[model samples]
Target: MKTDPTYPLFPICAFLGFIISLVPISWHFQAWNAGTCLYMFWVSVACLVQFVDSVVWHGTLNNHAPIWCDIASKIIIGAGVAIPAASLCINRRLYIVTSVKTVSFTVEDRRRAVYIDLAIGAGIPVLVMILHTVVQGHRYDILEDVGCIPVIYNTIPAYPLVFMWPVVIGCVSFVYAGLTLRAFLQRRASINDVLSATTTLNVNRYFRLMLLAFIEMTCTVPLSAYSIYINTSGVTLAPWISWSDTHFDFGRIDKIPSVIWRSDHAFYVSVEMGRWIYPTCAFVFFGLFGFASEARKHYRMVWMFLAPRISLVRLNPRCVQFRIIGTMP
Candidate 1:
């Protein structure tokens, strides 16, 4: 393994991204039980751990972070795989189960949607992981410092890390896409139909946001497939990044430097680069596209909360007070 001076920079930026994402997430924590929000929250957390493990914890420290972070990270890694599928399925169900004449969904339907999404988002991966543990070995290679990779990648009878999950997600996405296209056209059959919906229900916005979420998820599929291919085909696409800060006894040499070193398995490093991309894009889309009013409200709320005293300024001494309209009073 060769050293790259730029490697540390990648994880540093990724860690900062995960940290920044937490702010909006904090604002939305009370919203987890809402439809799609719970799955999205878990997915965000999974991305956070991916960044930490792949980039930040680069030494013996990797082996010794808070235990929950480790456990949560691994479980949600699989949960992330099922998230988009769960989202699309529930969204399509909402569209179908709603009043076609009224063009609106019910809160009761949304609550039920939450349950179905959770089942798909959390259930499939847990079952697969359990099956893997019983059929394969332990998921992580702690003795060799492989971190939290599935043993299915390198075990005998070699189950793929990618195969069934991608197939399932792809199948679900395809069905969702077809159904959504038809729904979109039927609802927008004319400007009257659209304006009628705008005045009465405005349910189209929910569908649009669902479409945006699917688009973002679609973009991540290629990267995911490549990672899977590498593992399944037994190709060492990348090297392992070991926790290099540990002391190694080399018999002849007194000690080995424990700083960051390029190890085997570069697949993880490459995948980590894109790990934050999907969650980041999805979060931004949800904020601006789905929760535009809420985002603006939060922005204004924060601005006023922070700078309520600077609303207007006095330019001159002789009763010359001018109200600052836009910014920087």
Candidate 2:
């Protein structure tokens, strides 16, 4: 086997991903989970882990970090955040279609929609984790002159590699979501016979689906473009730079001797471009949080709208309203 230094961080990140995915399942059984709510819950876990890991870990670790550790941390962190955005957009599409309908669709149909979306968002990551483990042995190689804990800055090659999966998944999901919403919109005015729903309900579904698609694509395009730029460039910020102040006076020729060496052009380009792209990702992340906030607000509105109409009793008398026959005013 080749001596590669980054093996350790992989297990850590993958384990974190598993934990993130598992929590929603637990919530499902424990929290009386609604289908739409479960998707949001799953997304929250992914986003939290990614946000914490990327910002905290990268801020500390310097170059000479291990390969496996670096890659694992980034992948887990990026996916944690990006996946939730994707899932929410998907959930929005499903909810707008299914929820507003007054038709008596089977429980199985609802469950099928939920599981299919889950598979699209979470299933791919699970498969990738398994494949990575099987192909590469579990242990990660530690980097020289690095702290025991894994960090992203010290780990150079791993940065682009880490975002590879998340970018692919996010872009694909965004495209699918956009197309689905567009199709729905084109059919909007022509939805002649919706399943026993009022005109207001039909209008809500039409508008919400389009809104979800718009949000998903708008947020994802920046992230995907940034990821692709970094990946293609093949350079990373110096892990050492991330840690130490490199601003010491090089003008002191008496105190220090500078040695010139042949530079890798590809590496230089990667570093320069990555600087810009990284911040683009940060912006994408902020946009996603905004999207989630909007979703929470929308969910509350949905519940509020439904509350007056729903009842505990199967055949509540309140479900019907009677009009008095012609009485003298």
Candidate 3:
């Protein structure tokens, strides 16, 4: 099946997601919204991975920049997988869990927690990619699969390394969020009391934040499943298309080493479909839904700043004409 017709949409989605993520990132004041910044950081990374994928996949440069193309392809793919999940994990552990359970919070505590989150969020991906590379035989060649370079897939380590941990973390978060939501909803803690009422409001607020994390998990988990399915399925998946040079309608696909990670036509195309689309969904969801109220505030402020400038620019042309006439006189 000629899937190339749909290829154009992925890049467009990637670019759009990248642009949307900037809104929350810009609004983030770390002191007030530290967890949000942590979450948004990974969301931005995922979007960035897609944006780069859009560029190199459809363009002519992927194969030529082997080191960059190969290393970046793996790292970003890992980033795409690990970062958002790690962000959610961190947000749940530090913010939601801590708040509801009355967990202690000290200056060093937050610092240590954030450092851990950043390290895990960023580190795991790199480590996974490297391990994947080693296990896969370190193939640095142009992975001219589908329209773009495919990430590490179909490896033994991928399940535990790439997919399992995130799944576990997301599950833990969802359960805690559910429990926390129950506490707020049931009002068993005596809603008539002012202190309890305030606690409900606080828990409700934290639960909403957790919901945002859940939304991210909803977007990402399916992508991972789809990848695992297509790769591991017994059915003959796209036997018609080759992941090799024969499938290449254009460009010089050089022979490079093969890694432990492998790809087939079905899996490659399947991956392309999900890669940008998931992150795009994630970025848009968080950008619009997660930050809806905040976004409106920011949007109003931006309009206030830009409206006068726009009016001035509109008025400038006439002023320029008048000034020209006056100078001539």
Candidate 4:
């Protein structure tokens, strides 16, 4: 297997992202809403999977751990859908908070909102995972330094079954984000009152959440669109096919030679983009929320909890040396 100089960077970035994404989840566990938590959870999962996959398969195409690859490949597919779905939940929540006509939200209304967010954030991805079996071309593909990836047949059914959800969810997220922005602009004077009355959002947190949703949608839509175009362009398939033919053709399934991927430019670009997207999102999330006042407080709490123990450990070595010398004398 041929190696690329850049292969090593994938694990490093993915590992960093996995760690950075976990900070908000662990530190601000109670502070973040379900949507934000779900978003970070998917990010963490994707990054961790990439980190492990890259480290194991770096500069090699051998399927050393086929079972791990199988599970990771499914996760890779689910996470691609889950992240955008979570963004939609966040945007939708903001839109509701900003556009509500009622002056106060009831407990049932808050509970209902949480339920909807959870449904969209968690439910849709599970549905997509079930749907993906229809288009899954083969068992999986193991690329040099890229590890195992799901093989989706680029066909008419794959458009709706696999490729379009991210773009579609992203478009919906964009609409919600736009409406939320418009509502925020129109009610800037009373926005704080509305937020305090309706939800746990403060002005800064509200702005950051809105901005994060906007950014994620903006990135997700176009990237997904481009990916679809690249995957489908110049390829001709029957315009219509029977479900049996298009569905996972287990009878004809076989391993693709790893060397073939080395020369497939389009596939390489797609894989490269997929590898970087989660880490980039993680970095962006860290830039946005990693240093906020609440995050800083968590950091201080962690330091305070660890500092005494660390000091005692450091002092114990010297104390041990002194005790040994005294005993010898």
Candidate 5:
């Protein structure tokens, strides 16, 4: 099968995104809370997986690394849920800090909030991973350029089992974001006081967090809903069978042909969107926070650390001294 022209771009984009997503986590680590950390972690992991997948199976259905695919398939499932889960934590935290009732939070209250965020951000994804087995139609599907992805039987149960969590989490996050926005509007004059009293956020970081959550919710909810609609509509799904029959369906492994993907416009759109969305999210995140004053400080520190080392390996000593002498004039 001829390779899609866009296939080569996947690995490059994913790899760049992976690198970009790591900047805040590695450099300005202290600026983020558990929720932001979790979100970046999920994005980085997903980008790494996509990078590997694109490199391994670009324009081919060769299962070069089956073991890796097994692990990656599961990671993809968890990552899908974890991202929105993390966003929920962010919005929920904003809601808590902005609530009028939270006049001042003690250390214990802060610890409790962290625990709650961890539970929602990390716990729910684990639960979803376990629940995914019920609707998993087969081992996995190896698609050209996309590598291995879990196969969910488009049965009645799959809707609740696998497809709904992102939308559900997104909707809940929207509610929290709405509440937070209302609180902010009402307390605009004293917003910094409200945040400083309840959390570590200053005006800048607080608004950034809010904007991040809002944008993520707006994108995730509609995309997830549309994904569900496209995957379900205009297709005759296999009848619902017993859990065993659905889970252990015959032909446990399959390689999707590229023609099948290209033939259907909606299917193609969904597939491409799934492939590109994580990198897009990473880029969006970088755009939102990568240039913050704290991030820039980290950037300067990184440059400072690297500059001396780079200067030590002078390609042209004569040119370097000449440049130094030029500065004297």
Candidate 6:
């Protein structure tokens, strides 16, 4: 019927997504992952739009923030919600053609695509958020400092916990990335033969998702592993005011550090370095690849395998064609 209830759910979804983005931001001013940062940037603009929309037309902030927010806002809310929202917006034309043009696809197939997007886009993020919330809430007294605040939870303790966050993030990201990539590839293969520039562009759109997933996982995994290594073995003597040193003594209380020296776990620095290196690569690669991919496909010359872009890249090509049901020639 009416384009799968997006208008009704858009407001709820947008606020939740914004809240999710704020979580990492609360973790103290470290840079957000590439995807999240972009999403957040859009969200800020979206929030402003909502504010303007309400003030200009007597709309309330509570109702406005999410409702007026962009589609990227929907996707960030969670994979379950985001995926369907993306699908509805992404494949609206396809669904319309299927209905009016008498395309061979069953309504069930259309629904399935919607379901898959929801599953991948919303499901993955929700799962990770849950896991992180439950198992990774470490204990660290928030302190005012110039550098970023360290999260020190049992799941992220120096010895055993350090490895937890990175590993969890890495594993979740790895699985999601792999599945998303496979799906993108499959979609690309299916649509590659369609000569219509529109079809090609639609399919190629999926490539961006694959690239995004790949960038997130690849960038974060090694960092996680390195974090685990540093947390486990790299125990450095704390400064005079370190929480550990203040609360518990490791028998070196009297020796104040005139100079800092590496302990047995100094090699852990290398692991931390590796983590940074990999994600830096991912960050750089994602930026370059996205720019290039969009440029190459700008005229709708290539077959796309993923959903279309909302910003930065545009694939709204007119070549997207539709054939009536059973009318494939």
Predicted model with the maximum TM-score: 5
lDDT of 1 by residue, 48-87 (tens): 6555555533433344443643374355446546555555
Go through the candidates in order and give the C-alpha RMSD of each one to the true structure. 8.5, 15.3, 8.2, 4.6, 4.0, 18.1
Error of 6 at 287 (Å): 2.6
- Which of the two candidates, 2 or 3, achieves a greater TM-score against the reference? 3
The clash count of every prediction, one per candidate, is: 10, 19, 4, 0, 0, 27
lDDT of 5: 0.82
Model 3 residue 143 CA deviation in Å:
5.8
lDDT of every model, 2 decimals: 0.47, 0.41, 0.51, 0.80, 0.82, 0.35
lDDT of 3 by residue, 125-235 (tens): 566665564334234334332223433334454466555655665565556555555664565454234233232224334445556666666655565566567656864
Clashing pairs in 4: none
**Candidate 5 weakest ten by summed lDDT:** 314-323
Using all chains and alpha carbons, the TM-scores for the candidates as numbered come to 0.64, 0.43, 0.66, 0.88, 0.90, 0.35
Off by over 4 Å in 1: 4-8, 16-35, 54-56, 59-62, 65-73, 89-99, 104-107, 142-148, 153-162, 190-204, 235-291, 306-329
Residue by residue across 1-329, what tens digits does model 4's lDDT show? 45565766778999999999878776434644789888999999999999998888776667798788778888888999999999999999888888886556666876787788889988988888888888776778777677788877777777788889999999999999999989888988888788776446777788888889989988999999998887777777545466666654543424444467647888778778987899999999988899887789888777657755664322232343222323453
Off by over 4 Å in 5: 26-32, 101-103, 249-251, 312-329
Candidate 2's displacement at residue 153, Å, is: 16
Candidate 6 lDDT by residue in tens digits, 36-80: 333333333333333232233221112222232323222222332
- On the 0 to 100 scale, the lDDT of residue 224 in model 4 is 91
Q: What lDDT does model 6 reach?
A: 0.35
